[model samples]
Target: MLQHLIDQDEGLRMVPTDRNELTTAVGQLNEELRGLPEEADPARTRVLTRWIGIGQMCLGNHDEARTVLRQSLDLAAALGNTRAVVATGLNLGDAHRYAGDVQGADALYRSALNTARSHHPELVDFALQHTGKNLMERGDLASAKAHLQEALRLRITKGDAGLVESTQAALARVELLIGRADASAADGAVPRQWSGEWTSWLQSRTTAQTPARWAEDFPALRDAVRGLNAHQRVYPRHLRDQPFPAELIAAMAAEAEKAVAADGYLHNGKWNAPVGDAASRFAGQVDLAAVVARSTGLEVEQPHTAVYIAYLEEGQFLDFHVDEFGFGEANLILCLQHERPTAAPSVSTTVFITADGCLECDLAAGDCVVFDGALTPHGRTPLTAGESITLISLGFRARDQASRTVTNLPPVPR
Candidate 1:
């Protein structure tokens, strides 16, 4: 409940901004804590403690949060509790991160990850996801990739939807930085000729929606899409591997290469523009419909929402984490891969939005992919060498999410 309150008010808009209000809120939680059964449930107590910590943290009571989180972890240890350990670690690590103690935060997270391996692997996945995020911020690319990759693997294996979306977000950033297609959109409308029917017709023949043989009629697109599916296939460890159709893989690789080679795609540097890119379709009008439809495959059920974009470059990557609580209804990322040579990798990942497909398909020379921003926990993977135009758009799904999220914005706008 306190976390929900925090989600609703980062600036303490709901709670009085005075120290008195902070004191009262903590005091109320304390009263409940004193009554919490000593042996009834250490796990529950730990959970409650984490919440108390969060309420304190956002209310600018960092010291209080640390104390609460520490107590929470200690109680869990007494109960031989792994969940409490993970929860308390996360809470403490978050406090450390917020307090500018990155190293300390990282240590706590690493410890949590170790504990997770034995006691709570699921929680470990989350720990790695968070640690991966911290590494990204520290510019520790290789470690970031490993941690994020592990998190992605664990999330997918367990079908943990929340972490999956978050992992996808992180992977996209990694691709933008290293495997960037680096394609700059030609100064033209999203190609008046493109349509989802064309894409669907093309995509259906390749994945679960359709079969690969449909291309017998249009061999070029057929070959391209077919080849794409094959090339990107993660060959199974067992024998009789599903031969990632060589042609299919090559075709997508060619497309990724072409996309990256396009001008306007950054080659190997940084560029800055106004954080607000005028909506090409409507002035003072945000087409969140387009974003939602494209990213999530879900139609907008409401009106009166706005959308906007934020761009990043080679050295740019966001922390691995959930989108801020109440920033927008959903977040959409349209990546313009920086144009590059033919042998490079194009970035993509599976997503976890209950709305649409579970993955962000590989973007081609000119593909605009979207995913549920707020519902999906996401971040970026560090890049080795490349640039990208990541079009980040947000629409308000619920007023509270929009308001609660966005404590930190990508550096470009600031």
Candidate 2:
């Protein structure tokens, strides 16, 4: 019931895939399992354990998952459940691979393949497919090709289009790996040809973003996250060098005071991703957030802005990225008003400037930093692990929108 409540509550409806949620959900499942009969229902227990293990693995808790899934595999073996064992072994292989025990992964895959042979042809083929994948990762191209080919033949004979297509894709990937792997081994430091091509391509594409360009295009922040998977943080860096002003801090506090009880949909008075049921918060807080937006000439793009709230002792941060694509010409971090009385009276933006500035700006409660968002996708060096720090942002499309009736400091001397 507790898990259900969290899942159902809109306020608690964060991304299910996030590590926090995964860990929480697994904890809940463990509690429920403890309450069950010692014998428990075998099938139910297996299913729950598998999913919980998968969730744990997702959160980088491989050791915990390994123990749980090993138990699950043992149960499967007791029931002669070949398919279940195969699935468990496959995921276990992944855990081992990620944990850097490649040899262990190879052995497990081989074991699963052997176990699956006595089962149906489909099961056998499935096991072989995974084994081939493992072999490919180990650079055993001949064995990988042989296993994958056998799996492909079995799928074709069984007239299973899905399996056939999947095996074929795997085969193609293996061939590609072999081609690259061989070259990688020979070159000792990346193939010179590919490196040269990539370098030239990067040179052609590289162009630093200017602060003024942020004012020219109103890029949405939500759109930027979709393509920036490799980036570990997301906050503006260019503005961290500047000192936070005293007057701006006062204005920000005043505004945060006005935000009390003003939240509706998107503005949950808490941190939330932009989406339906939160859209109202996005548009409603615009007036308050715009103050910061215009000051920095940066727009907030969480799909739903008003719904995005950062609370005291809380902050929202995006980890590193090039912030490429048309997400925005630049990114800005704005200091918002923290109206509620707290240990920290005012809010400030913190930008870790890395260039000649080597400067760490206080990002005073109201002062904001503006920087090249597109060229250097920003992110907090260390994403706050506790609840996200509360923040207000405006994803600006036009510079006119950035300080709409709001005043910004003079641009640093060019």
Task: Give stretches of model 2 more than 4 Å off.
Answer: 1-28, 185-414
Off by over 4 Å in 1: 1-28, 34-44, 173-414
lDDT digits (tens) for residues 1-414 of candidate 2: 223322211211112444565677779888777778977778777777776666666565667767777787787778778789887887677566544455567778877777777664458887888778777766688899999999999989999897898889888888888888777566533223332332243223321122222322223322332332122223344333234454544444444333433432332223333212122322333353354355454454432222234444334333233332233433445554433324543333243223222223444344455554433333342223232243444343433333211012111111
Q: What's the TM-score of every candidate structure?
A: 0.38, 0.39
Candidate 1 on 40-115: residue-level lDDT in tens?
6666777778778877776756567778888888888788777877878877887766554555687898898888
Name the 10 consecutive residues with the lowest summed lDDT in model 2: 404-413
The all-Cα superposition gives candidate 1 an RMSD in Å to the true structure of 21.3
